[model samples]
Structures are given as C-alpha cells and as structure tokens.
Target: MELPEWHGPTDDAELDAIERKAFADSAALQLHLSNKSRIHDGVILEQEATEGAKSNQNHIALKDNGCGEFHRLRTRRLPDWSLLKRSCNEHRTKVKYPAIKFGGQIVYSRTALEAEKATNELLRLIKSNTHAHSGNEPFPMGLDIEWKPTFRRGERPRKAAVIQICVSRSHCFVMHIIHSGIPPLLRSLLEDNSFVKVGVGITNDATKMFKDHNINIGALEELSSLANLKLGGTAINWGLGSLTESLTSMELEKPYKIRCGNWEVNVLSKEQLLYAATDAYVSWYLHQILKRIPENSCGDEKPNQANAIA
Candidate 1:
C-alpha cells in the first residue's frame, strides 16, 4: 500500500499555484489572539454585537465564506477561522447526502447531489484516502504532509479508494474536475457548452480538488451553471456506481481490485476512461431526466443522497 515515486503524480508548473495558495492561507490568518483580540463562533459574534466599538480597541476582522453565506466580524468579537481549523485539526465532517446503502456498502446517488461543489471537499477526502491506504504521508492536507506515488495492479476493486462527494450546486463543472482529479471525462465536460455537474457531498469533493487537479477553482458554481444545464432536485447517486445504475440501468464496470483503477495511469485504457465517464455523464443525464418529472411525483418522503448504492 506504499506509494512509489515517479515524476510525482503531478506537474510542478500546475502545482505552483496550489503551493502559493496554501502558503497565503497560512499567512492570512493569525494563530494567536491577545487580550485585545478574541475568538468565538457565530453565536459569540452575535453576543459581541453590542453597539459601537471601544475608542482604542485594536481588532482584526474575521469572516467565514462558508456554506453559501458570507459571515463577517471584527476579530475582536468573532471566531478566528484558523482557530476553528486548529481545533478541528482539519478533520472531515460528515454531512448528509442523498445516497443509498445496500449489501453493507453504499452506492453514490450522483444526480441527486451533483449540485454540490467538489473542490470544497477534496483536500480532506484525498488526505483520508491516502491515510486509509497507508501512503507515505499520514495526513494528506495537514501542515506536515508528504505524498508517495504508487499504483494498484491487476483487476481493480470496485471500492477503490474514493470518498463520495457532491457540491452545493451540481453546476460547478470546473470544481468537479479539480476535486475528482483531471478525469478525461471532465475535460470533455469543460469543453461542452451544455455540460453541468450535479450531486450532494460537495464539501467532501472540495477536499480532493487541489491534489487531483492542482487547481482551487474558487468559483466553480458560477462557471458550471453557465456552461451546463442544472437540475433543481437533489443528487441522484452519492457515488458514480449508483448513478450509472440508476440513470443508465447498467452497473459501472469496476476497475481496481483494492482501489479505483490507477486514475493516474497516464495511458488509461479506453474501457477505464469509459467507466469513469459513465459515472460522470450517466448521473448528469439522470438528473436531467428526473428534472422533467413533476415535483409532486418525487413524493413527500424526505430522502437522502448520502452513500448511494448500486
């Protein structure tokens, strides 16, 4: 399960930007707070909203552009993003998605959750997958992280190491490519004038965005919506396999034995690329199909897009 070295699984030129961004992130936020500065969550910010500021109070302004809303605060009263991150230890938080579980495994409901952004969730997922596989790096996204490139040979496993993810808006085409790595299928989506991304566990997807494609794509939602058609409903499958089965009625061909096929095989076989594309496009199509149906028919049931089953 150890990763081997190569030209590294990335292009240095491409990674340069990511490295810069990571560095800037570290610098922009402060770790220590003096008596003059304080840290608290949104709730604390609400409490500290008492009238005007003191004449001599030196304060740092804080804002969290999280979950579709921008929350701004003067550092004197609000939580410091860096502090919360330190407390969380960059841990991944599990959120709800519209997926199904069967045979002790969950299938991805891609369409239902395609609206979610993937880059927002990529770093955490990549870090987790690397750890699960016992990569050289213990944590993929922490301050001290290392990466060793390796490959899984032979018949690939269906449960190749992938943490299913969806975005807040399925329409973020660029972000999807960034999170999922540069799957050839994604390149096609980017070229297509009518391509769109759909899904639910977008935050998880965002974690892997950088490592996979070496791109941050901060504005994926806006870009995808402009290029592709988006459905207002929930994600169809939480992962690619379930999305394929639900939308195309065909079980996705599993590639790797212990992990998803070596996505970075460089010379990926046609069938492998086809399988990957199937996962992306089938879900896209299924979402479109379901969009044509009346909302009332979707039923009053409160469904989920987490861990979809094939």
Candidate 2:
C-alpha cells in the first residue's frame, strides 16, 4: 500500500508554532507518535524497495540498520470499539424519541448526467462566494465519503462508494461513485484551493480518493485540526460523533449500522442517503460554529446562541 503524503504544516514558522503549542498539551505525545508512525512506515517501505523486495500489504518487513537481517514489524491493532458500547436502557430518560432530525434533503445521483447537474450547481456556489473578504467566513461546501466495510482480516480496503457534498443545510448531493464515478465538474471543485472543503479526518478520505481514482483533493481542511487550533490546550481529538455531541448536544443515531450498510448497491436506501448527507451537513455546521468563536477566546467562549441550530 502506498503511504499518504504528510500535508500538515510545512512552513518553518508555522511548524515551530504548532510544535511549541502542541508540546504543552497532554495529548501532544499521542500526536507525535502518530506522526512518527507515518514516518517510520515510509522508511520501512523505502528500505524494502531498495532491497528489491515488495512489501506485503498485511505486514511490514523492516531491515535492522545495525544487523543485515530483516524482521517483520508487528502492526498495532486498535482496541475493539464495540466492547465499549453503552446500553440504551442505561440512559432511557436521556434518549430522544426520534433521535436525529436532519433538516436537509439528500439528492441521490445514480447516473453520470444527474451527478453532473448537481456538480455544476455546486461549482456555481463556489464561484459566487469567491469574493468574500474574510478568511474566517464559512465555506459553502462540506465533504464526506462512505464505503463498504471489510470484515475479513488482511483484506484490502474497499474503494469509496459514495462522495457526499453538502452545498447548504437543506441541500446535499450524493455522488454514487460505484455507479457514476466522480464527475469532471466535481473533480474541478475538489482540486481548486480557493474553494474550501470542510470535513473530519479528511486526509484519510483524500488518500483513498487518490489511491482509488487518482484524484487529488485540494483546499481541504480537517475540522479536527481547526478545533485543536481554536481550543488550544483543552482540545481533544474528537471524531464526528463526539464533536457533534459536544458542540450541539445531539446524538448521531445508528451511525455504525448505516456505515456498514450496502453502499455498493445500485440504489441506496433512504437511511443510507440520510446518514451520508447528515455527516456532511454536520461538518459544515460545526465549521460555522467553530469559525464564529473569537480567536483570542482560548476555548473560553461558547458558540453564539443565535447561530446554534435547533
């Protein structure tokens, strides 16, 4: 597998600032380990190539610089997240009757022509918003991707099945990648730096896009990074679920069920469409909230009540 390029801070001043700030945080060690793992993995791959041996997708063979022999590096497996699930009965009083209320319409495009039309409208929105003077102004686009689950161990990861883009709170376009692939207009928007793309853990999604379709996603900003920058020492690397719950006090109901659903199918179920669209829409919503917080507040400021979604 080709390792993704590290696209984080590159400028010396920015890197120094990030390093200084991150070093003061308790979670900084974890961040350093994550970056180190990427670098170490890249080095192992390079060594394998120099030795005229192809690296296995399932395992990494690293040559001991001191010794001439190569050894198989043990890959770290994450803990079973399913074991940590809480029973709904434990918090029956807290649960809402109808859990999620997404005030958005998910537009599914199964054909290329239909997908192209949606992409065109999205491009128009991006172009119209180019004249905004404020750097902190909310970008009109929120992006997210979904794919089929890989159950068996040692199996290659699946390609992205759906690329969901939310142009507005009430309007989302789901591009059926398995059926229609990425439209040229959509690709153009993704590659344009002036058009801001907001999402959580977006680098992983961008890597998949490049690996599967050779499409480069430009002008992308990870919401997690933004949150860290804004919150400073108090920041936690929260995923979509935690981030949404923290900011909006809303639960993303049955995300796992919809995530593992049959995304490769020709026609997606209403639940699948809603789940994908809501994920994208929430990213945009969170971006709006985060951007509104004053830069000097240092995690002390709450989101503006008027701007909060019901």
Candidate 3:
C-alpha cells in the first residue's frame, strides 16, 4: 500500500533531531535496529499486515493521476510503513524483505502472523548487538503521541473515531482512541499539573471523551484549556495529519481513512491495529518534540484553556 506523503516544509535538522531523540529514549531504540527492522521485527510485536492498501474515501486520483489528501480523497495502501518502521537487526535482509510498494495490501491469517513473530525475534538479536546511533539516549523519558480517529460502527457516526494514538519516545508515543468512558478519569488525573496530558487535536479527543466516554470536560476544557495553559495549540489545530505534513513534509497514508472498516471486530489483525496505532502516535509525537524546545523558540504556543464545545 502507498503510505501517504506529507509535502510540507521540513527541515532535515528537525527530523534528524527527532529521530535521534526517539531512538535515544524509546524502548524501540533500546532494542537497537534501523527504522525498517524495528517495525518488521519489534515495534509491532503483535501485529502483521493483511490486506493491500486502498483509497480512503477522501482519496481521488486526479486527471493527472496525482492524489490529494485534503482537497480530494486520501490515498491508502496496506503498504508497509518503513518511513518510521525500524528493526534491531543489522543483518542483510533476504531478497524479499523491504517488500514495500503501493497497494491496499494482502490480508493475513492469524497463523501467518506467527511467521512475523519469528522474523522479529531474529531482528531483535541483531538490535541487541548493534552499536548506538548518534544522540541515542540510554533511557530518555519521552514519547511521541500521534493519533488517527474513527467513528463508532453501527451508529449514527456523530461520535467520530479518534482511535489513532502514537507517542514518540523520541519520535512519538503509543496510542488508542479508548473513548471507552475513561476520559474524565484522565482529565481529573491531569488536573494535578504534573500529569501533563498532551495531544494534537486534544479538543476533539476531549469532546469524544465526553460524548463517547462522558468526560464532562466540556468543549472549552477539551480544546482551549490546554491552549490557555500554553501547553499546546499553536498555528495548527493539532490535526496529526495536518501537523505532520506541516512539520515533517510527510503526508501519511490516507486510504481507508474515511472509509469505515470493522473496528469493533473482537480480534483486529496486526496490520489493522498498527495502522490505528501509527495514526495516533504521530500526532502525539509531534507535541512531545515541541515540549522539549524552549517555548519562545517554537511557533505561537497558544493558551490551553480556550476550548470549544464539540
């Protein structure tokens, strides 16, 4: 599947810095693998790709055959995400590895996933022996937190899905929509100040937190409170996809994005879960980078208190 490409202005230094930091402090970095090996081997310990990538409803091939993620429909590929994928192995990949191309992706059976586990284990061995990349922290305390959202299946759909959550330990954090009635608890926990809840489109999360999870945080608290606190919300609204594009010049895979898939399936395939995880992680990860920089050095850091009702 074709992974979405964000074409926004990107400074190599910024990306390099984040990558260095991610591997330095992240569990994945601790594992010691190149970006590709990690995903193929360790990052996705429980998931495997199944199904080729396809177009998200937002995706549309232009007359020129070019696709658009915002103005038109989003493109998708069950394509492997090596852009951020990593592995601990330094051994040469077999002839078929790095088998990434643009397509929806072939679906896999649970049994097929077993094969992946074996491969990851081997890669882990290599990571264990590899030397460190520059800027690799022994045990940094950070994560990237990106997210992708979705709506509840078999319902009216007003309560959209915001299930994507990736944290950048350096690159991002691991994430989930978890709109399952726990938002208030998270918010109450955050009131302690040290709790430090961060997000890209946190307001959207907060609204869903209340709508789907009865968060009671209200629109203002969900959206503006963090901005008022000057913790998040700069020129962008924390739309992970938009922010990633703005920051990384990396447009993420958008296919199957607006398309409703079987999210509630009791047993989600590894590929499906990873797709969900990546979306959430990227958004959250972006801010983790922001928090490390001196506030004034970054762009307009908005008040976290000015939230809007969903």
Candidate 4:
C-alpha cells in the first residue's frame, strides 16, 4: 500500500495523533522508521510510550526486534564531555586572527596557548586591582559566546565556537573552543562566586555551555535580570544591543552579516573578532554602570547589601 508522505507535524498534539495513527498502519510505521535513523529511535519510543499511556496500555508493539529497552537506556545517557573534548582536540587546528582594536589597542588570542596566557594575565589583574580591596565589591567580568549560524532547516544547532571573557576594559580573552576547549584556569574563574560574570542573556549562554561543552558557568550575573530588579515593575528585557545604547549613549556596531558568519571555521575574520570582543566589553561596561547605582534610585525601599558583591 502506498502511504502518504509525511511533512513535519505542527505541534505535540499533531505529532501524537500522527504517531498513534502510524502505530495501527504497518506501511506507515515502516515508512516513518525508514526516514528516521536509529539514533532517533528513542524519540519514536517516547512517542509510543506517550500514546500507550493515554490509551491505558502498558506496552506498545515494536516491529523492530527486541531493541526497545536498549534504545530507551541509550536515550537516557548524556554525551560524555571527556570523549567530546578528545574528539574536538583530535580535529583541532591552529587558527590565526587579525588583531581588532579594543580599549585603544588591537587585541586577539590566536592560539589556545595565547588564550590561556591572556586568561592568566586577566586573573592576575583581577587579583591585584579588584580582589585586593576589602568590602562587598563584586569583581565584574563580561561574558559572551559566538556560534556558527544554522543555514538550513532541520540542521543540528552549532556548538559555541568561541567564548569571550572580558575581565577589564583593556583586556578581553577570546577562547577558541573549537581549537581549545575551556582551559582549567578559566574554568576556575568562571565558577568562582567572587567574580560576577555579567552578560545580557547569560541564562541561555549558560544552558548552551553546559549542554554542548559540559562546562557549568557559575557566578552568573544576568544584566537583564538586574535591570528588571532595578527598574521595579518595568517589563523590559533589554538585549546587549539595546542595553549598550541606553547605558553608554553609543550604538554598538554589530553587523548582521558578520554576526551570522561561520565562527566554527579555522580562521576568524577581523570583524568577527571585533564583534565578539565588543559584546563582552559592553557587558563589562554596563555592569560597572549598573552596580554603581544607589539602591534607592532603582526603587528598592531597603538597601539590599546582599546584591552588593565585594
């Protein structure tokens, strides 16, 4: 029997209906199984389970020999970070970058070693300048990520190509994740509570980092969250672009074409470097301005010293 060709379903209900229908039709079930690879078998099984539960059935018939249990177990297993790191390292090749100007100087970390060195230098600066002081002062660090754009439909999302951490206005360390995964020293700083990792949409970044690279980004201070708290009932979720404009009174230069450029490639264009650096730099700049505002100015009746990090 010739079964109808399936397009993508519109929603979970539609998908469930389709799955339920397919389960009753052998030809349609085979066609669905043929289109989806073995890796997607878990999704199929999950749909089957959902259908079964709705019908008050304990089990669903899998025409595929007894591999249902195995598939379920495999689906629950998370991707091993060590294996992923090794795989990336094996394919890793050194990439060069043209220095882009930041804080009155051209800056870029071309290699993993250079990135690590820059991170160390930034830590030293943080220790001497910020940490040395005694008070509830937060050591503010700007954080951002760059990823390759997905050009086609149904393509797997790209991993974070590079991660930029700006500890000081004059210094931004652009760590090449494809070339070198997050270094140990940098990881320490990221997890440290004393260092406030400030970014506009950092929750999404943190989720991606943990999901893709298995790196837990602690000490996150989301600027958007801070803005909401400061504004007191103003429903404003400002992105880096708009926030920078409002805070600094200067437009941030983020070209659309450059923003969508292939960040996973071996060599990064000068524009990409500048764009990544400026994002983190702006985050750092905005954090500085936001932290300095008195509690009363933001409509906080009580001085919340807990928000003050020092």
Judging by TM-score against the true structure, name the best candidate: 2
**Residues 1-310 of candidate 4: C-alpha lDDT, one tens digit per residue:** 0112122212334323332332233222322322111111222122222333432223333332221222222221111110111121222222221222244222456566766776777777787777444478667788999898775779999998889877664456667777777778777777778877899889899899988888888878889777555534334546675555333334565666778778887867766776787788778766765664443232324233343222
In order, candidate lDDTs are 0.29, 0.58, 0.33, 0.56
lDDT score of residue 3 within candidate 4? 15
Clashes of each: 71, 0, 109, 5
Please provide, for model 1 over 1-310, each residue's C-alpha lDDT reduced to its tens digit, 9 standing for 90 to 100: 1112222122333223333332233233333322222322221221222366463353455543321335544433221211222232322232222221111111221221331323323333444444343324222110100111243456442212222222111211112221233444333332333322343233334444444444332312221221122212222223344332222233444434313334333233434333333333333333433443233222232113221121
- As a whole number from 0 to 100, the lDDT of residue 98 in candidate 2 is 25
Q: What is the lDDT of residue 215 in candidate 2?
A: 94
For model 2, which pairs clash? none
Model 2 whole-model lDDT (C-alpha atoms) = 0.58
In candidate 4, position 200 carries an lDDT of 86
The sequence of per-residue lDDT tens digits that candidate 3 reaches over residues 43-160 is 1221223355321222233321112223332222211111233343333232221211112212121222332342243234325433532244221111122223333456554443
- Tell me the TM-score of each prediction against the true structure: 0.29, 0.63, 0.38, 0.60
192-255 per-residue lDDT for model 2 (tens digits) = 7766788898888998999988899887888987866654543444577655543443555555
TM-score of 2: 0.63
